[model samples]
Target chain A: MPQRIVSQRIVSLVAGLLFGVGLILSGMTDPAKVLAFLDVAGRWDPTLALVMASAIPVAAVGFALARRRGAPLLGGSLRIPTRRDIDARLIGGSLLFGVGWGLAGLCPGPALVTAAFGIAPALVFTVAMLAGMFTFNLLFEAGSRPRGVAKGSGTSC
Target chain B: MELAAFLPALAGGALIGLSAALLVLATGRVAGISGITGSLLGPPDDDTGWRLAFLTGLLLAPLAVVALTGRIPPVTIAAPTGLLALAGFLVGLGTRIGSGCTSGHGVCGIARLSPRSLVATGLFMASAAATVYVIRHVIGA
Candidate 1:
């Protein structure tokens, strides 16, 4: 109801729209293409690397601007992570994500978009992904801070 | 440089990064896809409206593009449906365990210069590269 909330919502919507469009345009939504890229032996598609390279500058500019600006338009201070250490959680998660990507050849963004096309496999992937998320919540519920605490506390926001 | 391939890749990456920047500027929230999707599982709340809207747009944009372009490429999967499902479950679990995904850690997390995100993103990229290698070379899957 607040103007800030409305503005945030609008921005979020726009961001998601653009992300989806990007996935489609990048040819990332195509599982076969992604698989081909992953397939280094047969025919390696290095397009993804180029995409990442191009994205880095855009992300860098965004980060620089947000850092300079300090607080966001919605009235809260930006919460960029300041640490750069490796841990078990990071390693474990990466391994799992890699395996999933290798098998399905569809990461989260494109997976959802492809699902919209009514592809049975994509639908299956989305369903499983949602279920996996739910399972994670159930298993690691304790790690998630209470919403009230997260909102009020300055840590881990 | 093939215009068709090069242009799309450049545009898409830029668009994704721009959207992420806009979301941060507007909402002060990291444009992490996992977090947005994960939020759906919890209890209903007014806060969910924006997340839902964002997700809807993600699904709809492709349809709009396809309608205009008159051709939507078919999706291909190397593994069977069951395996893909299992993999999805694993990703979900990993995200929960790790507290973020590539977008969260790799994009926003790295931007924030969070050590955790950096480590997470590094591990993710390395593991992904390794997995691809193994799958293609070793397993031939």
Candidate 2:
């Protein structure tokens, strides 16, 4: 592998490590803590909001600093999303995601982190999530191939 | 207000931000967990190396903490099995269709000031709040 690939992997590894630690430290790995926050009719805890509120500004500063450069330090173009259009897909999908999030108090990042700790619910969740993704690809992309279209070449964000 | 909980939450949130910043600065990839994981499931492409590495780091995080502190933090889940499965499925499908999740749209997107991300984040938060209300008050789950 090239030296750039090595550096990119290292950077991604370290960044992911820090992100997981942050998730643990913020109590996001605990589904009960998340559920507690979501239970507005019960004991409502606002700690998770505090997590987002704090993380966002710091990320904003980081984004501003990174944009000053032409490319990333590891020598690749940035993969930032450029879409500004909002449609039913965006709203509908977000609503579905939120409902699921509220139902289980686990999303992708936290669920994966929790599963690493050998949590059974999270483990099951991770498997089911992967299955769901595969189902989406099959239903939406796989069978709809045109005459000259290639496999796995459909549009996705 | 528990000062003990407040401090750690703030510190951890800051650490998450730092990580997000570092990824964007160093590799120019949005630290969106769902998108990264979704791509991993699709094909055995050359990009698998980094995604695996990043996930390995996530798995190792608690171990690293345990090594440092000599104890793992406590975690609890109150939802039943069926709900967990259904919710996980919806999250998977929704994130794939929506093209982002909390970390992607909520944190990184908002940080970059993307309008679509802003809208997605708002809608999700509202829907989550509503779900909680209905489940707790109406359904009493």
Which pairs clash in model 2? none
Query: Which regions in candidate 1 have their CA more than 4 angstroms from the true location?
Result: A82-84, A142-144, A151-157, B1-4, B44-47
Worst 10 residues of 1 chain A by lDDT: A148-157
TM-score of 2: 0.92
lDDT: worst 10-residue window of model 2 chain A: A147-156
lDDT of 1 at B32: 71
**In angstroms, how far off is A121's CA in candidate 2?**
1.3
Candidate 2: stretches off by over 4 Å: A141-157
Q: Highest lDDT: which candidate?
A: 2
Q: Could you report the DockQ of all the candidates, in the order they appear?
A: 0.57, 0.63
